[model samples]
Target: MTAPDSSAPLGVFDSGVGGLTVVRALRELLPDESIIYLGDTARVPYGSKSPDTIRRFSVEDTQFLVGHGVKAVIVACNTATAHALPLLQSTFRVPVIGVLEPGVEATLSDPNCERVGIIGTAGTIRSSAYQYALAMRKPGLQIHAIPTPLLVPFVEEGWTDHPALESVLHEYLTPLLDKGVDTLVLGCTHYPLLVPLLKKMLGDQLRLVDSASTCAAHVKTLLEAQNLLRLPGEKPTLDIYLTDLAEQAEALAKRFLGSTFNKVKKATL
Candidate 1:
């Protein structure tokens, strides 16, 4: 493995377009750093796949990014991180970070945080990664986790404001609300897109811990510590790649990335 250079782009990948939220956060927090994002649209939603399959897919994804000579790789997919982070870190020479630990740390940062609610894909919840991490940090803390499999599709459909979405959200959040959870962890990257609606529905008392922003902050700290931060004043670029581009890929990318959206190239992995 070659020595990591400060000017090299940061590589990020997910099972699909949701990882763009991480890219969006990175662009805001580390404007001087360039980014290379890979969305495996061809095999989107690794949530339902077996752990072995998820690990294999994640290896290929990391291989593709490492081949591009990135300074570090960020596993922006919650499912991928839950299942394959250790393997990827061992296999790759560059620094490998995941979205899970940062979010967990952020969630527990508040001393008053007692009751917590977590919502993510079925696979992420089933893996118990977040639950385990949180419990390990704060013993006897009250934690409630729900598998919000339906929320992802609604978010992708751009129906955050739809009246029907309110009902769906209500159904998913009632258990947590009943348990009196004060902090809510948005476990999936796609969940950040619904923050506005979530705030309006859940109100101000419930603190929302967005994994995307927390992960970006963590990335910045790590890069700084390793002396790999790109120098300031140099215009940074964001290159996007996808294993397969669906018809709605561009539109969905725009939704997740907002103004940071760029033309995506096809990645043969």
Candidate 2:
């Protein structure tokens, strides 16, 4: 049942549809919460942009969602989380969560882990975002970074497995393996789709961190603490928005949300 007088939906934004993985987790875990997801599809990959550019894009995205009566916003893009999380939290009135902090928290809390590696787009690798977060939590942490640009494109094309995909993963992961890191953080939301290929390459010894799931757990806690938890009744209504409307977003919605989505509202921000 809808919460009496509930006035807004939960807002989520990513540079593109990759963040739908986070949306999928949210819908399965909190079925009653309404969600408004905005994908900056026109500028699909924020991973190569400068921090200034990412922050500006994130701010514009947040403003668009906030205008639509969002109770909270999730910065589902890793690049945005790295660059714009603090800005979003301070600028917005409602609770704002990002994928970075939660992933860092989870990795640090795992006592079995020693050295950690991060694979992301060039921008994320250049920012040293994951390295800094991990270091901040556990001082003297060994960190390695590999900028895996091709993985994002493969994900965009929905090609998780192809002869080309394996070639790309091998080429990208070579440096991280040389660094001998034990835990690999799937820094891009789209990266979850590549877990099987990554596992085959890295073997069972190296753990791949699913930042989206960690972020979802964090959202659950943050909402509860703020008295914003959605009460259960019927399934949640999730609305997807994209700067460039695409059939792909609509097709992928069910995989992420665990239910068929009828509405994918288009937007430009």
Candidate 3:
């Protein structure tokens, strides 16, 4: 197939509104580009689902975006990317980018990050995607990944600074801290929302790798190299779809996009 038109909108998907964090980064780095984001709100927590189910939902999300003539796809959900990125790349024509590799790359890019740590949902940590990716980049790399499953729901409830949140974070991060990890990878896109609190609890001295920003940077580089970047000064468009609860997704999108969405509608898979 011919290379996608420079004006084609880039596609992005997540199990839910958490993916908007990625869209936030993309807009910052590539302000002229159009974007279509799909949130599978009906299946919000892909982290707990089986790999087969996650893969199925991911394909449906990708196909839905492809139907909208997206030039490339971003698997913004760490769990979905961990389970289905390979299949999506092999089956799709456009570039398929996942949040995982970019985060790993960002973590290793820092020279002071010798003992790297990662925190994610149960499924993401169980997949060992970050560990494997880090090892591939640096054999014998000291890595620690812990599943802080509670953090997701906490963020959804807007409970960032609650006493309970601090307790849970300490419980989840103490082991990695003890292991002398100097850097932490926010493996789940949703985790970035808790950064200020995380830094407060873990101390400013610890470096944090935000996968969403790194993934967006990677997308910018790819678009530039392929000459697929949209021209500057164009008023970029954003169309968002959610499998369920469009209102909820719309409400949450404001937090991620830093503004109200221009178009938000309910759509299936």
Per-model lDDT: 0.94, 0.82, 0.89
Clashing pairs in 3: none
Q: Which stretches of candidate 2 lie over 4 Å from their true place?
A: 1-7, 247-249, 252-259
What residue runs in model 1 are displaced by over 4 Å at the alpha carbon?
none
Local accuracy of candidate 1 as per-residue lDDT tens digits, 1-269: 46899999999999999999999999999999999999999999899999999999999999999999999999999999999999999988999999999999999999999999999999999999999999999999999999999899998999989989889999999989999999999999999999999899877869999989999999999999999999987789899999998898889999899874568899999
Task: Score residue 82 of candidate 3 by CA lDDT.
Answer: 96
Better of 1 and 2 by lDDT: 1
Q: Let me know the TM-score candidate 1 reaches against the reference structure.
A: 0.98
| Model 3 / residue 162 / CA error / Å | 2.4
Off by over 4 Å in 3: none
Instruction: Please give each candidate's TM-score.
Output: 0.98, 0.91, 0.96
Cα lDDT of model 3 by residue, 77-136, tens digit: 999999999999999999899999888888889766689889998999999999999998
lDDT per residue, candidate 2, 107-167, as tens digits? 7777877888888888777888888878877888898887888887787676777889998
lDDT of 3: 0.89
Lowest summed lDDT over 10 consecutive residues: which window, candidate 1?
255-264
Error in Å for residue 162 of model 2: 1.8
